[model samples]
Target: MATRQKIALVTGANRGLGLEIARQLGKRQMTVLLGARNAAAGEAAAAGLVAEGIDASAILLDITDGASVSTAVQTVTEKFGYLDILVNNAGILPKLTEEGSPSQASPQLLLDYLQTNFLAQVSVTQVFLPLLKHSTAGRIVNMSSSIGSVTIASEPLHQNGPKPPRLPYAASKAALNMFTVLLAKELRPEGIKVNSADPGLTQTDAGGPNAPYTVEQGARPAVWLACLDDDGPTGCFFTHVDEHVVNNPW
Candidate 1:
C-alpha cells in the first residue's frame, strides 16, 4: 500500500505568515487545511494555492469560538483521518496608542488578546491532539513572538530600545510560550514534538508596514518546527532567521 500523505492544519491562514507556512507545506506535498475566520478569505487563499498546484483546502475557524474549533476538528478528522502537524498561528495584538504605550489598554482588550493568543491555542491543541497521536511523526508549532521572551523584556538593552506600547500582546505570547513548554513535557513521552516559534518583525497586517521581514521569512521557522524529526528538540523556542533556540524566561 502507498504511504499516506501528511496532513497539516494552519490557523489564521488566510494571509500573512500563516498563509506562507501553509504554502510551504503544500509545496512539500502535504495536504494543508487553511483555517481562517472569514469564509471568503479562506476560500480565496486556498484557491490561490490550488492554482499554484498545491493540495490545499480552507476551513472556517475562529479560534475564539468553541463551536468553530470543534467543527474544524470534526471536518479534518472526517477528511484526513489523522493530523500530522498543527500550526497555531491565530493571534491578535491589541491596538497601540500613538505614543506606543499600552497604558490605555482596557481589561476587555487584554482579555480578548488572551482569549485568542493563549486560551484558544490551548483549546485547539487539545481538540486535535488525538489525531496528532495517530501520526507516526507528530508536530505542534505555536506562533510566539520575541517580545514574549521575558529575558528580552527584562534586558537593559531591549528596555532602552523602543519599548512596545501594547503590553497585552507581549503578555499573551509569553503565556503561549508557557503553554508550549508544558505541553511538550506532557506529550514528549509519546514521541510528539511541540515547540514555539518567533517569526520576527515581519511585514504583515499585524506586524505593521514598517516591519523589516516579509511573510515568507516569518513562516520559515514555523515550518521548520512543524516538520521536525522524531529526535528533534521539544519544548524549545526558536526564531526563523537565526534558527536558534531563544532563552525565554518561561
Candidate 2:
C-alpha cells in the first residue's frame, strides 16, 4: 500500500533555505504550502515547484501581520482539514553598525527583528495548534540557530570560537528555542512533537557569502525533524550534520 500524503507549510518559502525545504518535501510527495510575504514571489516560487510536478501552492504570510497569518491558517485548514507539519522558518537580521554591536543597534531594527523572528512565530504556531492537533503525527519545526545557545555565549573559552556577535538575532533565536521546549512539553500528551532546528551557517542572505554550508546543508536538520518517527526526541536543539542535541558549550 502507498503511504498517505502528508501536508506541510513552510513560512518564507519564496527563496533560500525555506524554498529548498519546500522543494525537498514536495519531492517526497507531500503537499506543500509556500508562505511568503510577497504575493508575486510566492506565486512564482509555487509555479517553479509545480513545474517540477509537485503539489505546491502559495499563501500570503507576513509573520508580523496577524491578519495575514489568520487568513493563511483558515485557507489551509479549509483546503486540507489539517496540517501535518509546520516549518517556522521566517526570520530577520538587522544590519550591524561599524561597531558591530547590539548596543548600537537601532530600536526600530531590534523591534522588527523581535516581531518577525520571535513574536510572529509564536503567534502563528499558537493559531495553528488546533489544526496540528488534528494530525495523526503532528510535527512543529522551529528554525533556530547555534548562536542561540546561552551556554556557548557565556563561555569565555569559546569566545574566540566560531560564534560571531549577533545579539538581537541570537537573542530572538534563543527565545524561539525556549518556546519550542515549552510547547513540546505542553503538547506531548497530545502526541505532538515540537523541536528546534539549527541549519548551521549556510550560504543564504542571512548566512552571508562567507558561509561554508549550502542551503541543502542548512535544511537537513529541519527536514529530519519534520519526518521524525513516533519515538523521536522533542524539545531539543539539533544541528544539520548530526541529530545530536546541542548543549551549552560551557
Candidate 3:
C-alpha cells in the first residue's frame, strides 16, 4: 500500500505571495489547491506549478462570497476526502482615499475590511473544518502581519518607522490573529494546530519592488507553519526574520 499525499488549500493563490505559497507547498509533494476568484488566472497558476513538476490544481473560490466558498468546500470534499493544511492568504490593504488615521476612517470602510479579512476567514475555517477534522493531523495557517499586532500599533514608531495609514487592514489582521489563538485552543483536543504567520515586508505584487525581501522569504513563515509536524507549537504568532522564527507579542 502507498501513503496518501497530504492536501493543502491556499486561498487567493492566483498570484503574489499566495501563488508562491502554493508553489512551495506543491514542491513539498502535497497536492496544492490554488483558490482564486478568477477561474482563468487560477488555472494558469496551477498550470505553471504543474510545469514545475508539482501536483497542483486550481479551485474557484472567493472568500468574500458565501456561495463561492460553500461550493469550494463541497468541491474539496468530493475531490479530496480530507484537507491537511489550509492557508488563509486572501486579504486586502486599502489605502486612504481621504485624509485621516483610524479615528478618521469611516465606519463603513472599517466594516468592509473586517468582512473580507476577518469575518470571511473565520467563516471559511468553520465551513472547511469538517474536512480538516477528517485528517489525522490538521494545520491552519492564517496569514497575518506585524502591523496587526496591537502592541506594535501602540508603538510610537512601528517596525522602526511611522505606521502605514491602513488602519482597517491592521485591525482586520488583529482579529485574524485572535481567531488563530482561540481556534488553536478549541482544536487542541482534536490535535489540530492553528497559528498565525506574518511575512514581513517582502517583494510581492502587494509588497512592491521597494520592499526589502523576496516573495520566497515572505512565504517561508506560512510554509513552515503549514508543514509543522506533530508536537509543533500552536496558538502562537510568529514571523520569519533572518531565517529564524521570531515570536510576535499579541
Candidate 4:
C-alpha cells in the first residue's frame, strides 16, 4: 500500500501565528486545513495557501462550541479519513485590565480564559483522538505562552523578560501545559506525541505590532513540534525563543 499523506488541522488559522504555522506545514507538502470560527475567513486563508501551490482547505470550527467541534470532526472524517497533526492554537486573552493581578482578577475572568484556552483544547483533543490514532504518526501541539511558566512567573524577569503577569491567560495556559504532559504519557505507546509550544512574544495583534519576533519566527516552535520524528521527545514544553534548547517544566 502507498504511504498515506499527512493531514494537519490548525485552529484560528485565519490570521497571525496560526496562519503562519499552517503555511509552513503546507510548504512541507502536507494537506493543511485551516480551522476558523468564521467560514469566510477560513476559506480566504485556505485560498491564499492554495494560491501558493499548497494543498489546503477550510474547516469552520469553533473550539469553544461542542456542536461546532463535532461538525468539524465529521467534515475531517468525510474529507480526509484521518488526521496526522492537530495544533490547538485558537484561544482568547481577555483584556489585561480585566485581569489586573492574580489577587484582583475576578473568578469570572479566570473562568472565561480557562474555557477557551485550557478546557476547549482538551475537548477538541478528545474529539479528534480517534482520527489521530488512525495515522501512523500522530502529533498534538498546544500553543502556549511563556507567562504560563510557573518557574519564570516566580522570577523577577519572567520568560517574556519584563512583563506583568497575565493572571487569567497565564493560569489557563499553565493548565494546558499540564494537559499536554498527562495526555502525552497516555498516548506514548500508541506512537503519538503531545507537547506544548510557547511562541513567546510575537508580532500579532495580541502580541502587539512592536513585539520583537515576527509571526514566521513565532510559529516555528509549533511547526517543529507538529512535525517531530518518531524518536523525537514528547510530554515536554518548548519555546520558540530557545527553539527546543530548553524544555520548560511547570
Best-matching candidate per TM-score: 3
Lowest lDDT block of 10, candidate 2: 241-250
- Candidate 2 residue 133 C-alpha distance from true site, Å: 0.8
Clashing pairs in 1: 100-165
RMSD over all Cα atoms, model 4: 1.9
Comparing 1 and 2 by lDDT, which wins?
A: 1
Model 4: CA > 4 A from native = 158-162, 242-246
lDDT (CA) per prediction? 0.88, 0.86, 0.91, 0.91
Q: Clash pairs of candidate 2?
A: none
Task: Evaluate residue 166 in candidate 3 and report its C-alpha lDDT on the 0 to 100 scale.
Answer: 69
lDDT of model 1, residue 203: 88
Question: Mind giving the per-residue lDDT tens digits that candidate 1 earns over 90-148?
Answer: 88765556223567667777787788899999999999999999998899999998888
TM-score for each predicted model, relative to the true structure: 0.93, 0.91, 0.96, 0.95
Candidate 1 lDDT? 0.88
The sequence of per-residue lDDT tens digits that candidate 4 reaches over residues 158-244 is 644645558889899999999999999999999999999988788988888998888988998899999999999899998754434
Sort by lDDT, best first: what order? 3, 4, 1, 2
Ordered list by TM-score, greatest first: 3, 4, 1, 2
- Show where candidate 3 strays beyond 4 Å: 96-99, 159-161
Error of 2 at 33 (Å): 0.5
